[model samples]
Target: MTVALMWEARAVAGKGEELLTWATHQPLDPPPLRRETFRAPEDRVLVITWWEGTYDTEGLPELPEPGEDLVRRAVHRWRFETVADGV
Candidate 1:
């Protein structure tokens, strides 16, 4: 099975670039199958990582949160399992 983890955060006013830089530089000890980063209006940043296990798997790698001052609110995270594929 394939598991994908999503992490999203909203940066403080006028610090979108700094927040994006911070998110891209974070390292996963064992690394995931794939990872991607994105940014949006209102200074929001999103990171998604794909792994080869279930959401409850032990010791799965995940990105840690950045400093409090970097963001305006708590980060949001979610886990999902792939259920279908397109031709």
Candidate 2:
């Protein structure tokens, strides 16, 4: 099945441009880039990306995560295979 990987993070202080730069410049291969973003009511931004490929976070490089607080960066990737017409 098709999958959609969503990630959201608040603008740190005045890091809006930095945030977008970091996300857009991520170095990941085998998964073609498909990214979109939006501004929330509270000014927080929501960035959703559709990665077309198998789901394997374990194999990907590790990202920075806060000790107590939630990840500044997160991923919600889902993988689904296609079905045959005769199946």
Candidate 3:
């Protein structure tokens, strides 16, 4: 069975681009990322990503800074399992 993970992240402060750059560099392994960017008012950045493959079952990848790594300020991430798309 193929699993797809849905991820969303909000950039802290106004460094949305910077945060995206860092995230793009993060290696999730196995399933690659298929992401989309959203721009909010006040320079806030939101990203929606979908990854398909067999993950570690841990849901998320291990990063140097899971909560507060290399970011400008705060970061919030939400993950979801893909149910049905383009079906």
Error of model 2, residue 55, in angstroms: 8.7
Q: Each candidate: RMSD to true structure?
A: 1.0, 6.0, 4.4
Ranking of all candidate structures by their TM-score, best first: 1, 2, 3
- Put down candidate 3 lDDT per residue, 1-87, tens digits, no spaces: 233443445555656677667655667555446656565655455555555544445554433342554354555555566556676
Badly placed stretches (over 4 Å) of model 3 are 1-33, 53-56, 62-73
The residue-by-residue lDDT of candidate 1 on 17-74, one tens digit each, is 9999999999997889999999999999999999998768677788888899999989
Better of 1 and 3 by TM-score: 1
Q: Which pairs in model 3 have colliding backbones?
A: none
lDDT: which is higher, 1 or 3?
1
Superposed on all Cα atoms, model 2 deviates from the true structure by an RMSD in Å of 6.0
* Candidate 2 residue-wise lDDT, 1-83, digit = tens: 33445555655555666655555556546554555666554325555555444454334332232222322444333343334
Q: What is the RMSD, in Å, between candidate 1 and the native fold over all Cα?
A: 1.0
lDDT of 1 at 16: 94
Q: Which candidate leads the pack in lDDT? A: 1
For each candidate, what is the lDDT?
0.92, 0.47, 0.52
Model 2, CA-based lDDT: 0.47
2 or 3: which has the higher TM-score? 2
